[model samples]
Target: MTEEKYAGKNKPALSQSGVRWLWLAALVFLADIGIKFLVLDRIGYGWGNRIEILPFFNLLHVHNYGAAFSFLGDQAGWQRWFFTGIAVAVSLMLVFWMSKLPAREKWNNSAYALIIGGAIGNLFDRLVHGFVVDYLDFFWGSYHWPAFNLADSAICIGAVMIILDGFRSKPE
Candidate 1:
């Protein structure tokens, strides 16, 4: 028996969608950097003010030389190059992933953009100052969340969106 043959299946194109994804990524990166500049100029590094917006929320400025919560902070000099290398590698991988995504995969695309922006934001800091500038602080009593910046927030939000999208059916 002859094998069944199929032809003319319509594959979704991603050229346009990839461009949009890139544009959004660029915008987020710019915004993240712009805010950092403003904060650096107006507030200056290592300077922060606290406002009681709730029972357990405050904004503050803190520079971190290591990973989250200042882990490996005491390494003295190795972490700067280490984290910078990691960020650069991840950014490159994410860009390749973004290019491979189909047009209908909006959620994935957005997630990629966020991750890219965040990576670049931190990468810039590491390259320029050897550390990251974190300004958002949250705490309840003696417990305090690690200080973070807008780039971190974007990365978190994008990750959540991607996880949620996975549970949903794939777009046609």
Candidate 2:
């Protein structure tokens, strides 16, 4: 194929790349922040203020000071900046990767965009609150899972999509 065919309508390489899907990232980021702030405004923090929504779920405002599942949340400090740095670095790297992929690579593009969105969303929280805001709560019988927010969910979903993409059959 000629450069015209690859670039499409005289667009630049970056514009023709999977970066087109960045709108999805922006959407996820906006939605994540909107809900987080709304929760912050309406819900009182901690388990004692949980609002049960189902037999297995609840809306419980909480704060995570570390990585996923509160990996080092108990630390006096430092983990906050550490995770923030990771999020910033990962978001930038994914955006750059997306800019190199062809627009047709929707699967990988979307995965990258989702992760970028989620990473930036949490980064925003970390910068603004010094912690990640979590609200969704799920439990089974007497076992309760840690509360997490939409940003966390987006990151998990994006990661799962990337992992599943590895199993997809490639074109010859």
Candidate 3:
């Protein structure tokens, strides 16, 4: 297929670019950071300091030195910069994609904006704090899921939206 056919016929003008959706991304970033600071101020850090909100939920403050689910959290500390780099790169790439997309492509534009916001939110934490602050916790009986923050939640939701968009039927 030709490039135009594959990319679609939007040919958005400078003002019609999906970059308009950037406000959504900014909102996500602001909300994420705001909640994070609130958690830091109100909750003591670590599992032992958690405040149970419900049988299945709690508010706890903690730090993740690595990527999602603390992928390399046990590392000596290199993971901080590594994850930061990845977040920066991904946010830039998504913004570029958004710029090329049509303003009317709300679904994809929103997804891109969400991811960018989440990435930048976490990026801000990494740059200033040297770690990502996680506060929300969920548990069931003897099993507990990894703690995460608003930034992580936004990223996951955005990613799921993108995956679902892929399964949507196209007009052809």
Best by TM-score: 3
Candidate 2, 97-128: lDDT as tens digits: 77767788899899989998999999999999
Order of the predicted models by lDDT, top scorer first:
3, 2, 1
> How high a TM-score does candidate 1 get?
0.80
Better of 1 and 3 by TM-score: 3
Runs with alpha carbons beyond 4 Å of true place in candidate 3: 5-10
lDDT of predicted model 3: 0.89
| Clashing pairs for predicted structure model 3, backbone only | none
List CA RMSD, all candidates. 5.2, 3.7, 1.9
TM-score per model over all chains = 0.80, 0.91, 0.94
Per-residue alpha-carbon lDDT of candidate 3 for residues 1-172, written as tens digits (9 for 90 to 100): 1368337575677588889999999999999999999999998888999999999999999999888888999999888889989999999999888878778889989998999999999999999999999998999997889999888988998999999998988665
- Who is ahead in TM-score, 2 or 3? 3
Clashing pairs in 1: none
* Candidate 2 stretches greater than 4 Å from native: 1-12
Worst 10 residues of 3 by lDDT: 1-10
